[model samples]
Target: MKKIFTINCGSTSTKVAYFEDDKMMCKSSLTITAEQLKEMPKTLDQLEFRTNQVEDFLKENNLDPKDFDIVVSRAGTIPSVPYDGAYEVNELMIASVTYAPEAQHASTLSCLIADKLVKGLDVPVIIYDPTCVDSADEIAKITGIPEITNMPVAHLLNTKMAGITYAESMGKDYKDLNLIIVQLGGGITLGFHDHGRIADWVYDDEGPMSPQRAGAIPTRYLADYCYKSNKTLQEMRMYLCGQSGLVAYFGTQDVRDVEKLIDEGDEKAGLILKAMAYGVAKSIGQLCVVRGGNVDQIILTGGVAYSERITEWIKEKVSFIAPVTVIPGEREMEALAAGGLRVLNNEEQVHPYIYYPKGYSSIEDIINNPNELA
Candidate 1:
């Protein structure tokens, strides 16, 4: 049996799993407190510390790193890669994550830790379906302003895995179906999966509001607030991405707590929850239009998908487009393990990591400088 080790680093926790082929033998997670994060402000700085945690876990579990044939880590927000799949972790990937504009996420340490742990072993380290996966169609890239393009960034890992799982359940090929995947969690991302490629997606920051994210708001109002609110760029980002949504209105980021308030006859909380679902349904409707109304299955996954209230609200608005499949909670770790298993079984090719320089303002620029992508 081929042994694979998978790691997924979230903002506050690191999940490590040992898999023997398709079966997970052991799994563990380490939580980093707010104090620890405050001391190690830079994501790359936590590399050695997090790697030590992984090593400790391996030692406690009586597993030898040398026995593992493959190691896979969740990808961080690197420079936008045009393709998706298992990417061999290399210096280019490490540099891209280390130097990217928004490299503050804990996931940036994934490849770094994996690289250190698998050294001197005949093991391959790979990162699968990073958050920056960009497979947008040409038309999908066009924005209202000529100077700005609609970049593709979303929850590619769980969304794509949910789609593939649903396709398999139907005994259909993932590459032969049109799928609209909605991931409801701390942030919500709605992706239009056309056949196999992700034609377009609403970036979570710009899509439906979630438990912690503000999602989309009126642009004119946002610009005015930026001018008058006297908040720094980082503060504004925190307000929009981390402290907004339910927390901004209800002072709590937990969806279950909000649901409890609703159950206890809080009309306002119920209305806010319904409004979030409505926003999600609206985004689904828009993506259905993007897919020309030929969606085969609408898949819902992530933390909030477990809530029947939210799913019912969304279903009422979108069941007309296609059948809805709810695969509750996250499948990210399993997805990483499955990707490593595929590569181990020779079912998929592992691609080399290459960094594309920033500042390509137009499609014409990309067309003109083909070697830049190389």
Candidate 2:
């Protein structure tokens, strides 16, 4: 049996699972409190602390890291990669994630911790369905600005797995269906899957507002507000990503508490929740057009998908397009473990790490000096 150790790091928790072949043996998650996060200067500073927690969990479970045949981690924000699948962890991948331009999340420390745990062992470290999996068509990359191009960033692992699983239930292959997937969690991303490839997806910052993200806003107003507010870049980043959304409106990120207010007859809470669902449904409609209106299934998967109120709202708005399948919760650990098993069993090939420089390559130079400009 192939032994696999999988790690998925979220903003507030680190989830570790042990898998023997396709069966999960054990799983544990360590949550870092807001007070503890306040003490750290940067996300990377928690590397040692989080690694220690992993070690403690392994010890408590009477497990040894060296006994595992392979280590797999949830993918983090890094330089864009072209394909999706298992990628062998290497120094280049680590360096890119460590210095990524976006806000630092706990996932950036995943490979670092995995590499540390498997040091001196022959076991390979792999990352599956990282957030930076870009598969947009050339036409999809065009933007109004000549310098700025749209990039593909979404909850790819769980979203893609949800499509595959749903396709199997219908006795069809994922590659033969046109699917629209919406992932509602701390942030929201809606993806359009054309055949097997993700043709287009709503970037995290450009989709519906979620429990903790601002999502899309008026760009012109944002520019004017930035000039008037005088907030630092870091503060603005937090406002747009971490401190906006429901937290900005209600002073809390917990959806259940928000639901409680609605249950207690809070009119404003009810309206806001309905608005969020409306935004999600609108995004789904737009992506359906992107798929040429041949949508076979619409899948909703994420933490917020558990909310019957939200799902029902979304379904009522978009059920005319196709069947809506609610696969609640982020099934990241299972997806990672399944990816590891596929690679180990030779069902999917493990992709080698290739460093692609930032920015577009020259259109004129196709044959020679391809690496001249990034």
Candidate 3:
């Protein structure tokens, strides 16, 4: 039987699991608090620390890291790759992620951790559907700003797997279906999968408000605030991506706490949550317009999809577009394992990681940028 080890690193936690063929053998997670994060500001600085934690987890679970025939992980900050699939971890990929100072996320450590786990062992390390996966249609890449072509970046890991899961359930291939995947979590994004390629996607700041993300805000107002409010770019990012949304209103990031507040007759909390759902519904309606209203399925999957309140609200609004499938939680481990199993079973070819620092797969060859920015 083939052995697979999956690693999923979030902002504050590292989740690792072991699998034999298709059956999971053991799983564990190591969590770090905000205080702990503050001690190590750089994402790569925590690499050795996280890799050691994974080794400890293996020891505690009586699973040897050396015994892992294949190691797969959630990709973090790689330069934009053209397609979605598994890519073998290599020096180019590692250096691209490590050197990208502006894009250092805690999740970026997962690739480093995956690389470290099989240092001496001849085990293959791969990452499935990284954040940089760009399979959107060429027209979708264009925007008002030329240099700032919005490359397809969303919750590719969970959402793509969810699409495949729903497709198989209906006895259809993922590439043969027109689907809209709604990824609701700490960060919310929607992707319009036209047959196989991700035709387009709604990004972080242009979608519904997540539990933490502020989502789509007025561009004119945001620009005015940036100039008048005297907040730095980093501070503004923290506001929109970290301290905004439900947390900005309720002083908490957990959806469960927000639900409790709603249950306790807090009209304000209830209103905000409902508004979030309303925004999600509106976003789904927008994506349906991508293919001229020929959506086959709409799958709501992610950590937040488990919420009956939000899902029901979205369902009431988007059920008319297509049949909605609720596949709650980010099944990244399973997806990673499946990707590894494909490599092991020779069902798919694994590509070597290539770095494209300025974001590859541009729709147009010539995009003017006098300042050479973004």
Candidate 4:
């Protein structure tokens, strides 16, 4: 029996899973809090801290990395997908991630975890269905941003994976069905699925002015505020991504807290909650347009999807679009493991979805001239 380890590093936590013969044997999620961040190692020193944590967990559980046939992870966004599905994290991909960076705490953490595993055991590390920026040709043309590929493709991939599992249980292939996937998480990612492939996706930049992010702010208004007010970039970022959303609207970002306030008849909280649900419903509607109004199922998945309040609101709004179902949490670990095994089994090929900076012909060309920009 071949064993595979799927490592997922979320923005706030790390999830490790062990799979044997495509079956998830064990899974663990270790959350890292702000207080932990204060005492935790910086970027360069994080490898030891991450490694020790995983090593201790495995030892206590009587498991070893050597037992695994492959190691898989969720990597950062590269550039653009040449096609679709999963891919391997090669030197080119790694270099691209290292050079042209984004706010990818999970991807960086995953690298540290993978480094530890590869050092202890000579296993190949693969990344599955990373944020594929494969915007439809028309969408790109409309957006006028060549880089604006479908940002929610990864959500679509995982949602489709879940759909297949659900369909298989009923002795049906997902390929024969049309589906809509609602990803309610740190952000809302909606996708239209046809025959198990992601046909189109619509995502809200930030989450609904939830307890966390300020959601989508009008760029012009934001710019005016920045100009009129004297605030540092960090301050603005914190307010926009963290404080302004539900916290700013209410007193807290916790959904439970918001719900409590709503139950207490706090009119303001009720309004905000309704607005968020409305935004999600609006996104679902946009996805329907992509499907040409032929949606079979509307499935909801993600961390926030667990909220009954949010789910109910979505269901009521999109009922006519199709039947809506909620699949709480994400399947990134399973997706990673599946991708790794696919590559190992020759069922998929590894390719770079991102291009090197400096507009170079290849990764080697960029590497050979590090001073090109200079």
Highest-TM-score candidate: 2
- TM-score result, candidate 4: 0.83
Winner on lDDT (1 vs 3): 1
Give the number of colliding residue pairs in candidate 1: 0
Give the RMSD in angstroms, all C-alphas superposed, for model 2: 4.7
Ranking by lDDT: 2, 1, 3, 4
Models sorted by TM-score, best on top: 2, 3, 1, 4
Clashes counted in candidate 4 amount to: 4
lDDT score of residue 343 within candidate 3: 88
Q: Name the regions of candidate 3 deviating beyond 4 angstroms.
A: 229-231, 359-374
**TM-score of every prediction relative to native:** 0.90, 0.93, 0.92, 0.83
Worst 10 residues of 3 by lDDT: 365-374
- lDDT, candidate 3, equals 0.83
TM-score of 1: 0.90
lDDT of 3 by residue, 1-374 (tens): 99999999987789999999988888887998778877876567788888889989988888877788899999886668887888988866665566542364667888788888788888889998787677777888888987687777888878888999898988999999999999998888999988877888997678889888899988888888778877766567767876789888888778999999889999988999999999999999999999999999899999999899999999999999998899999888888899899889999889877554554332121122211211
The sequence of per-residue lDDT tens digits that candidate 2 reaches over residues 191-248 is 9988878898886688788998888888898899878987786667767887789999
The digit string of per-residue lDDT tens for model 4 on 1-374 reads 77888877654567888888688988888676756655652332344666667777787778877777878877664565645666566667665555443443344557547755776467777676666646453552245466653344445546766787667766988889888777666556676677766667664453345556677777779889988877776456545754576767765656888888889989988888889888888877877877688887888887787789888987899999888877787777877777777777878887644555436557776555543111
Off by over 4 Å in 4: 38-48, 133-137, 144-154, 228-239, 242-244, 250-253, 351-354, 357-374
Clashes of each: 0, 0, 0, 4
lDDT of 3 at 257: 97
- Candidate 2: deviation at residue 121, Å? 1.7
The local distance difference test score of each candidate is: 0.84, 0.84, 0.83, 0.68
